[model samples]
Target: AELSRLLVLKPEILLLDEPTNHLDLPAIIWLENFLRTTKCTIILVSHDIEFLDKNITRIFDISQNTINDFKGNYSKYIIFREKEIERQIRQKKNQDRYIKQTNMLIDKFRYKKNKASFAQTLIKRLEKMEKIEIDAFDISSINFQFPPPLHCGKIIFQSKMLKKTFGENIVFHDLDLDIYNGDRIAFVGKNGCGKTTLTRIINGELECEGYFKKGEKVIINYFAQNQNELLDPNMTIIEYIESIPTEKSVSQLRGLLGSFLFSGDSIYKNIKVLSGGEKAR
Candidate 1:
């Protein structure tokens, strides 16, 4: 909705940061097309590799307190970055060798009275020489693993002749499917295709014209795309997590939050003050 509002303004330049956060696949596709055809200068900060590959024409990589501009998509920028790193390494090696040789000459001359003048000259030269420092590539990688799910029954859900419609617009008709335990499924289609609608119907959040059945011990934990919308803005991070019923201890909860990068004092921060990424976590 925010993206749509921004688009309607028809700004000559657009700046977006993680614009795809709550978007469904279809919405993302629409945005990709929109960006491709728009006559605006776009500046995007995104972690969506595929989206960046498809939409962006240039990249401004922030590293070592500098913005390195690359005239290409994310993939090309990656290639360029690797080559640049290699070049930097080579330059540093050469600079180190030169500095070492100069220092050795200075050291040899410093002791002799006759070479003292040359040593002073070399010392001055050394002082004037620009030192080369290698920027440390200390990139931190995040690893998150979900707890193994409980073993479910043979048939998790089965739907027959399922159909959904909003007024005159029909999303799906005569859809039949059998979902078993541990079955991974992904819904793909254009906007307003009723993917969410179908999920709601199956979850009993919405009524539908069809037959839907669930096996025994089938528990659904739905995480909406707009998950931040569900968070209590009035609650603090720790308080919000505590609000949910769990068997874990307070220390365990804190550890879990820490894994989400909400450590120490940050857990006390109010949900309203948290950024989009924090709220999402």
Candidate 2:
């Protein structure tokens, strides 16, 4: 609604932050078209690479305490940034090698009376050379994998004539489902289409009219769509992960969080201070 209002006003300059956060597919598509054709100069901050690639003509990359402008979309910017980093790395390596060789020459000849002047010249040249500094790249990625489920019956879940309603609105009705041990399922629909509601019901987090049954030794590890909202705001990342009932020790837990790119002092940061992406992770 806020985005709709902003678009209606047709402001000369539009600034948006994570505009596709909770938008459905259709809404995201419409927004992409609108932004592509809009006359306004837009400054958008989004982690949605596809959205940015579709709508943006330029990129402003904030890194190393600087804002670097690139003259293309997200994909192009990635290519260009990588090339730039490679160039910087090469230059730094060459410069370091030169500096090292020059220092060695200076040290070897500085004590000799005949080469004192040459050593002094080398020192002066080294002092005058500009040092190359490369920006730090964080390439850490999540590495944890889900453990294999314990042995269970082939029929994992079964439901018959499942129905859900809210007041006068019937979200879904007369639905039958059977989930097998190795079956992979995806529930896709537009906003408020009961996908989440159905999942919640299956997880026993919500009441529903249904004949539902779990197979022997079945276990459900549910991650809600609004999982970030369920986080304890005052708890640190490490504290929150530790609160879960697990046999992993502090060091192992830290390694797990590190795999999720939460390293160093970031593991100690309160959940309230984390960004949306960090919270989601």
Candidate 3:
């Protein structure tokens, strides 16, 4: 609704932050098209790389206390940023080597009266030299991987004549679904189109007019779209993770959390204090 209002105004400049947060796939597609065709100058901040790639012509990357401008889309910016980082690394290495060599030369002649003047000259030049600084980048890979589920029958889930309704509004009706072991599936639809409703029904979180059965040893771990809301606000990140029935030790768990970019004291932060992204993580 807020986005709709913003679009209705047709401002000369549009500034959007995470505009696709609760938007459905179709709505996101529509937004992409609108952005592409709009004549307004837009400054968009989003984590949706695909959306940015399609809608944006330029990028203003804010990092390391600086804003760097890139002359293309997000995909192009990624490549350009990497090459730029590599160049900076090489330059810093060369500069470090030169500084080290100069220091050594100065030390070698500093005590000698004959070359004291030369040492002073070198010292002045070295003092005047600008030091190169490389931006710190975290290259740590995310180490999150679900543990393999216990062996189950081939038919993981089966549903027949499924129907769901909210009061008098029919969400979906006469739907049949079969989910087998090793089958990857995605449910996509417009907002309020029963995608999440169907998922909830399948997860046994909602009462539906349907025949649903789970195969033997079938364990469903549901991560809802609003999963963060289900978290215990009083619990710290480490405490919440520890509550899960896992065989991992404290150090191992800490390492796992670190892989998710929650290192050091961050794991001790209460869930209530975390940002949406951090809570999701």
Candidate 4:
């Protein structure tokens, strides 16, 4: 509600750094839709892959002390980024051949007066040639893998005889469902059918007198999807993470954060200034 009011000014070129931080899924969706139609440019930094994918048109990627300019939305950026990397690799190969040839020629003829005659030209040639600019460091790499989640028996959670209704409208009634550990499902429905309400009920956040049971060893990490609301306009990334409880040593946290793809001075950055993608990462 507060953010909605704030956005009413329709600020242009919203320098949103992870604007979706504390927002719920619905709020995130609202932002996506708004940005899609909003005339202003949005410089979004977010780790919400899906949201960025759906809305953004440009990406300025800084890596290894150089900025990468890509000319489209995130999905297009992905396509072009891979191709650009390949292009850079090829450029390095070509640059290597140039350096090898130049060095060998210089070594072969450095001692003779006749060779010295051509040395000036050679020196000028080398000086004027473009320098090879390979990336200063390699981003980390490993085969992507998913961790084995704690295995529960057949049914992970169950809800029975669930019902919900607003003052004058019935959303759902007498619902029965069983969710298994390995099952991937989308709790989907049209707008205002209380799909989110069901999740809240199962999460025990809603007052439900009916049947709701949790299996053993359930570890729930609620990564609330509200990207826009999570942002504190004044907070930077490093400062914000320090405020949270972490088991990681500072160096360990730094290493882990690096793997998640943040780097350089990004650690010292404020949450408010970070893109949603950066924070999410």
| Model 1 error, position 200 (Å) | 2.3
lDDT value for candidate 3?
0.89
Best by TM-score: 2
**Candidate 1's residue-wise lDDT over 114-175, tens digit each?**
99999899889879988766555435444578887777789998989988888988888899
State which candidate, 1 or 3, has the greater TM-score. 3
- TM-scores of all candidate predictions against the true structure: 0.71, 0.93, 0.92, 0.63
Evaluated at residue 44, the lDDT of candidate 2 is: 91
lDDT of 2 by residue, 123-173 (tens): 999989888988665445688888888999999989999999999899999
Q: What residue runs in model 2 are displaced by over 4 Å at the alpha carbon?
A: none
Cα TM-score of candidate 4: 0.63
Local distance difference test, each candidate: 0.84, 0.90, 0.89, 0.72
What value does the lDDT take at residue 19 in candidate 4? 75
- Residue 214 of model 2 has an lDDT of 80
Tens digits of per-residue lDDT for model 4, 185-240? 88755546676777777666676546878777875555445545666757766566
On a 0 to 100 scale, what is the lDDT of residue 108 in model 3? 100
- The positional error of residue 26 in candidate 4, measured at the CA in angstroms, is 16
